[model samples]
Target: MNKLNHDQLLSLEHPFVKIPVEKFRSSLRTSQKHIEKEIGNLTDKISEISKKSVQGSMEPSQVEAALEAIVNRLSTLKRKLKDIRADEVLYSQRTKVRLQHLQDFATIQTLDSDEYARWSRVRLNRIVIDYMLRDGFRGPAALLAKSEHIEDFVDIELFAQSAKVEEALERQSCAECLQWCKENNSNLKKIKSTLEFSLREQEFIELARERRSQEAIAYAKKHLTPWQETHMKEISHVMGLLAFPPETKCHPYKRLYDKSRWNDLIAQFRSNNFALQFFTPEPLLNVTLQAGLSSLKTPMCYQPEHRNANCPVCDPETLGALAMDLPLSHHFNSSIVCRISGQIMNEDNLPMALPNGYVYSYNALTEMASLNDGKVTCPRTGAVFNLTDVKKVFIS
Candidate 1:
C-alpha cells in the first residue's frame, strides 16, 4: 500500500486542504462549553467560600486559595475567548475563498456593451434604493444615497414620513397614516378612496374589542355614519357587531374581532398611500423577481433532457390557458381578455367597443354576430348592438 502525504489526506476531506467551517465551529463550541463549566464550578466555590466567610467558619488560607483558583480559571477563559475570536476570523477568510470559487464556477459573460452594463447598474441601484425606501429602511436609504451622491434625487423627508406611517400601522395604530390621508384629503377624495373611513372603522373595532362599546358606538356615529351612503352594507354589518358582546363568537360578526382585520387595514392603507403618491403598490425588486421567475418558467429555458422539455411555448395561444391557472386578482383590468372567448386584443384581433362600452376581441364579436344573426349583445351589460355600432378601438 502507498502512504499518503499530510496534504493529500487533508485534500481528500476538503478541496482547499483546510478544516471545514462546521468542524471548526463545533470545536469552538466544545471549548466554550468546557470553559463555561469550569467557570460555573469556580463561581459555585466562590459563593460557598463567601457564605463560609460570612459565617466565620472559613479561614484566611481557604479564602486565598479560592481567590487564586477563580483568578486562574478566569485567565484560562479569557485565553479561550481570544482563541474563539481568532477562529472566527479564520472562518470568515475561508468563507470569502469559498464564495470566490463559487463565483468563478457560475461566471457568465454578458454580450452587451459597457453602456448597457452602466445602464444596468443605474437601474439596479434605483430599484434597490426604491425597495429600501418602500420597505421603511430610511436610514439605509439615506446612507446609500449619501454614498452614491444621489441625495438630490431621493426625498429623505418623504421616505422618513413613509417609514413613520408604516411603523405606526405595524403597531396597529393608524395615527400617522391617518394624518397623511388627512393632509391629502382632496387627492384621496378624487380617487374615491375609503382609506379614512376604513381607518376609523379599525379604531372603532379596537374600541369595541377593549369592551368600550359605548365609545365605539359614539365613534361610529361621529365618523362612520357619514360613509353609510357609500358603504351601507359594511356599515350595517359593523353596526350589527355592536349588538353582541365584545367577546361574542358569532358567525360573521366574530371575524370583526380577529387580529387579521388590523393587518388587512394596514395593507389597504399602504395600497391607498401608494396610489396617492402615484407609486406602484409593489417594490420594484419584488416585481422584477416575479417577472424573472415567470420568464424562467418558460419552456425555452428548460434543457433538452429536462422533464418540461416537451412543454408548449409560452405564447399567446397558451396565455389564456395559463391565465385560468393564475388567480383572478393577478390579472390587471387593462390586460384581462374577453369573458366569453378568452382571447386578448391584438392587431389582428382588434378590440371592438359595443354600445355599452364593453370591449371584446373582434373575432369574438364576429362569432357572437354570427351566432345571434348579426345582433351582438354585451356579455357584461347585456346591452344589444349591431355590427354597424361595434367600432374598432385602436389601443396604443
Candidate 2:
C-alpha cells in the first residue's frame, strides 16, 4: 500500500470516472441534436417537394416515389432516433442514480459508522420504472408529435379527398348497378331520401382504412345487393372499419406501473428514502410490457362500442389484475389477403404471398414507424450488445 502515492491513485481514478460521464453526456446531446436536425431537414424537403408537385414540375409517379423515399428515410431515422433518445435517458438515469449513491457515501463518511455501505446496498430504484425517472421522463406528448412525418401516423384507405369521391360518382363507367340519385327512375319517388345518401360531398374508403376493415366490409356485404356492390364498393369498403374500435386514449408505461403498484411500495419505502438510490432490481412484473401497453398513444375517434351498460373488456378488478396498461379487448385474430396482384410484406421481411393476398395492419404499420422500437442490429456487422452488459460494466 505504501508503494503508490494517493496522488497517483487519484490521477488514474479521476480520468476513469470523468471520461465515462463526459462521453455519455456528450453522446446524449449530440445524438438528440442529430435526430432533431434530420427531422427538421426532412420536413423542409417534404414541403418543398409538395410545392414543386403542385406547380406541375413533378410527375405523379415522381412525387409518389419521392414521398415513399421520405417515408423510408423517416422510418429509419425515427427508429434510430427513438432508440438513441431512450438510451440517452437511460444513461442519464443511471448516472444520476450512481451519483446519488456516491453522495450518500460522502455524507456517511464523517458519521463514524458503516451504515452508508448498508444504505447503498438497500437499492432504492425499485420505486420507479426506467422511463419515469427524472432523467428519462417524457414531457407532454402532443407537443412532441409536431413532426412533419405526423401525417404518416394516420393510416386509412380511401384517404382521398371528397372532391375525388365526387369525381368517382360522376364517372358513368364506375358502377354498372348504381345510378345517380337524380337519374334513378326506379326510385323517383324516393329522390329526397336517395339524395341524402348521394356522393356529391361523400368520401371514398379504399384499401386498409384501418387494421380490421375486413370485418367492416363483411358486415356491409351482408346488406349489399349485387347492384349495391357494383355501384357502392367505396361505400361498402368503409363499412369494413367497424371491425375494430379506434384508440381513444393512451398512458405512459411508467404511469401505468406506478398507478398499479405504487401504493404497495409507498409503505415499504418509509424509513429508507435515501437508501433507495442504489441497485433497482428488475421488476417482477415485466415493466417493459407494462410500459409498452400503458404508453400507447391513442388514435382519434375511438368510441368504445358497448351494446350494454357494461364495458366489454370486463370488470375493473379483473382488468387491474391483468394489468391496467394493456388493452386486452383488442384482438389480432383476423387475416386478409391483398386483392390485387403484387408482392406482399411479411413480418420477418421475407418475400411472401405473391400477387398481393398478404395482409397488413395499418395501425401496426403506423405504430411500427412511430411508437415503439424493437432491438436493432447492424446489417453489415451484426453488432449487438444487451443493456445488461453496459449495466454490468457501469456497476463494476
Q: Which stretches of candidate 1 lie over 4 Å from their true place?
A: 1-111, 299-396
Candidate 2 yields a Cα-based lDDT of 0.37
The lowest-lDDT stretch of 10 consecutive residues in candidate 1 is 8-17
Candidate 1: count the clashes.
0
Clashes of each: 0, 9
Per-residue alpha-carbon lDDT of model 2 for 154-254, expressed as tens digits? 11111122223234434422232124333334333432233322221121122123444554355345433333734475454334334323331223222
Candidate with maximal TM-score: 1
Evaluate model 1: give its lDDT: 0.68
Instruction: For each candidate in turn, give its C-alpha RMSD to the true structure in angstroms.
Output: 21.3, 31.5
Model 1 reaches what TM-score against the true structure?
A: 0.47
Error of 2 at 390 (Å): 65
TM-scores of the candidates in the order shown: 0.47, 0.26
Error of 1 at 304 (Å): 16
Output candidate 2 Cα RMSD: 31.5
